[model samples]
Target: MILPYPFPLDIQSILNNKNIFRRPPTRFGKMHHTITHPFHTPDQLPMTNQRINHEPVFLLASAPWRESSLWVEVFSRRYGRVALLARSARKRQSELRGVLVPFVPVSASWYGSQELKTLHRAEWIGGWPQPQGRALFSGLYINELMLKLTTREDPIPELYDALEAVMRAVCGENSHTAALRRFEWTLLNRLGFAPDLFHDGNDEAIRAEETYWLTPENAVVPIEEAERFNPRNHGVAVGGNILIQLREGDFTHPESLGQSLKITRLLIDNLLPEGIKSRQVLQQLQQFSFGV
Candidate 1:
């Protein structure tokens, strides 16, 4: 069986002097309108915006819904995390199948008062290139973090901007490591879970030569000063230089990368007790050389 180029255009249509699809119905009234899009607008942007369109979103996850539709999770600037039901999106001629993919910047219009909004329409907002290889996994990891840590409808505009910027940075092979660390810090900070990296638990300025311990209670204690407080558990111990590097936010020192990972891993897992599956996937992928 074969399906033609997809377009959910209405039956009634007119051709201009150029014989183009003039004012073809773009609204999502019914799911039966099946037309191929061998010739469609550039980047698959809807020829018109007859419905409510919000900020561009990144598709986090999508799955089959019924026989012809799809249930998707997306992170947007305005709405944060949202679940959408895209009707007739699985039809061979439907235009949304191509746009509702992970990592793509999509302009999506939806409506509903319930937790799941009905997808009115979608279009690919093409501009930046998608991540490939390990960066791709890193992208998935970010999506998972958004899903697990972020609250639905609790819009964090700054976090959205940070995410969008990191998405672009991760496209570069070597930049993914630095970009992921920066994004992780931003996420933790936005969620109010990040500690004051600049100041230690003792409220003293961290010196580069000292050794510090990160307590389970989210405080940094210098090893030399720990005897004064007689704290029971000092938690993971790290050099003061590593703590300072984390504060720098750039991970300029080669050692900061690994130390940053250890620090963030401990902190994030404490928040997500169920664990991040994407993180596990990344760990497992370490055995294989994708040259990324």
Candidate 2:
């Protein structure tokens, strides 16, 4: 349930500022919605090329803003993690209301300062199924990872593809543990933080019998040296079999998957700077719930 690290942006602060958003009145006093808007349009306000031509994005997590809007955090393919204020999507007849739901694909439109942006519109790309229970938890895990690693306005197209892939894997009948692991690993790599799994920086082959640890600098060293460099105690001396599997992007191997889980969780935990609410909920549920 514990976070690997602290987040740069104050998610708690943003959550506390939910008074600024407006949630629409519903029969049950709650309404669910998802919305997507494109990155550019002729109608958009004049702005620099940097802000005007952002790539299409996905809004992965959102909370009720106030009475009629949403405070959303999105994973943009070209813009990395973006915080936006989606206004008035909760009206009874609003198309955006139904389109703003999480785990669904949507292209978002936004403009603002280099920090937070204003969400102008959204359009759904209806091809994926909604996640439930454990799948929902897994989706949240992906969202959390994106928020933790990506910076605002930074592009990460590869992570976006990996994310879409995970969403597909989660919606299917199969358990998405392996898919999630690969996405996590890919995120770390795209962020320029993941350690090399196979060869050394000099391109020397890794010894199959030796155990090695991953450091932030992408260095693979003997287990003894790991303790000296691993400030967070999250590094592991993984088996070479797992390394080979990772090199091949093979998630089907049970041993490889297990190692991927261990190593990725460590790296993410160590690298994340802020608290993750969903991750904590997931851990508690996993520990206590058997029916799940």
Candidate 3:
């Protein structure tokens, strides 16, 4: 079957479904088509006046706004990813200033009807420890990935849980690489574009002794078949055993973590837009320090 260019990956649709055991759907044998911008709730309510009820949320990202108000983006357990205007948060005297930092859990309340919601109250959860150095950067990378991949007001409770787990791992001083790999694998699977690591395009199960190549549109295949259908330059070659382990999310296996790092990098690079600064910074850091 001929594959379409610029695949949707149908991340949202997949996550919304309660059933995760079924084979996720695939798009193929079609002409190329461009996807339009997803429908956003810009017109649903004026961000400046609507009121959002208070609830516990994970602070994903925050930036300064005006003189005192800070523009914050949070992944709320109840409201999903949202934009909030935290009044006077940038002020040195504001209690909310330090409480809303990224990776911190906060109980936030807001009200607004405009495109930008206004923050009414924020209280820190206070128990979780701060992430340091590389873990901090890794947390930012996770936030960036969510911002780029998720839609506002769209809830992925499972993804939220995974994010919290990653934060916990980071806070407890676990290997950031393992944390990232697991979280990323879950994120991709949570979104519909999860790779079919255990099977070929023709529905045959892969053997552990074989070598394989993966393509964004075609899933996985034997290296020989991939070279015949598409040039070797177009795909990333990986070991079959790694593919099987990834299929099972066996991140504890030494090979799984290593392969996860490699495969996730390729997937993110292929999925994201060009000139993403985070990716550039990550590449430079890798060159200077090899592995994280």
lDDT tens per residue, model 3, 245-274: 786767788877877788887776666644
**Model 2 segments beyond 4 Å from truth?**
1-56, 112-114, 201-203, 215-218, 223-234, 273-275, 286-292
lDDT of 3: 0.66
Q: How high is the lDDT of residue 248 in model 3?
A: 75
How would you order the candidates by lDDT, starting with the best?
A: 1, 3, 2
Q: Which stretches of candidate 1 lie over 4 Å from their true place?
A: 1-52, 225-234, 285-292
lDDT of 1 by residue, 1-292 (tens): 1111112211112111123322222122211122221122223332222234756898766655568876677788887776677888889898875677666578988876555667888888785666677777777788777765665556788888888878777764566788789888888777666666676776888888989877534467787666664456435678878877776786876789998888888777765565667667676667565655
lDDT of each: 0.66, 0.63, 0.66
- Model 3 — which ten-residue stretch has the worst lDDT? 1-10
Q: State how far residue 39 of model 1 sits from its true place (Å).
A: 37
Please give the lDDT score for candidate 1. Answer: 0.66
- Tens-digit lDDT track of model 2 for 223-280: 6566666476545677766776776678887888898888877766655444466777
Candidate number of the best TM-score: 3
Backbone-clash count (model 2): 32
